[model samples]
Target: MSSFLGRGWSFPPRFDPRTKEAVMVADETDIAESLHILFSTNPGERVMLPNYGCDLRRMVFEEANEQTVTEIKELMRKAILFYEPRIVLNRIEAQLVDPLNGKLEIALDYTVRGTNSRHNLVYPFYLHQATHPVRA
Candidate 1:
């Protein structure tokens, strides 16, 4: 029983030396395609990503913030160009909090992204959708 549990298949001696030559590296096009395949415009558990050198920090938007529709759209545009997120949803949330536990108030929620590891077989794709509004 012990032998059977430990026994496993072995590669041929001639092919023993596994080289990195066979590994196919991903390029810009490959990454974009992978993103498309992973994220859908409409779905569940949409992902949030960190791009533009931004870290994965908690986001909280204050209602008093002077953010306009145009600004939000512009930010979305830039994000689309840079990270190529699937799309931005029509809904947005607003709140005020100290994410870093500092005295500053932030105006934003979370944004999703696709991959973390460069060598990951599947790149992560982000999807942004406005969450459903709750009734009082």
Candidate 2:
């Protein structure tokens, strides 16, 4: 029986060159991978899927504050709701790790659709200035 029998099909299906077998991902691991991809990809980076990806990167360039945190949460909500059909968001929180350095931490709580399983994930991102001064 294929390893993918009970587990759902893996996204971005990979294959082992040596064994010539498809790599299978299931459950939490697969969801985590999907979330990572969702967070890492910048919007408009995907050719045909222009609306895909999160705006978290853009938020890094902005000043980190209460408003920024709220914006981040909202962006997360919108992006997740629109992109991931397999999970439903339960809560999202964002806090400034260092306002001066434009570092922020985000926490997301979600439940997999069709199942009662719940999961939480935290992500850290740094937004640096577009231009930096050169010290002599």
Candidate maximizing lDDT: 2
Writing each residue's lDDT as its tens digit, candidate 2 over 23-75 gives 87776667766776777678999999998998677765776668878887887
Model 1, residue 65: distance off in Å is: 3.6
Best by TM-score: 2
Q: Candidate 1, residues 15-73: lDDT per residue as tens digits?
A: 23476233232333344333332222222234553234221111123222345323433
Global Cα lDDT for candidate 1? 0.29
Per-model tally of clashing residue pairs: 11, 0
- Model 1 stretches astray by more than 4 angstroms: 1-64, 67-77, 99-136
lDDT of each: 0.29, 0.73
Model 2 stretches astray by more than 4 angstroms = 1-23, 129-136
Deviation in angstroms for 16 in model 2?
5.6
Name the 10 consecutive residues with the lowest summed lDDT in model 1: 4-13
Question: Cα miss at 91, model 1 (Å)?
Answer: 2.3
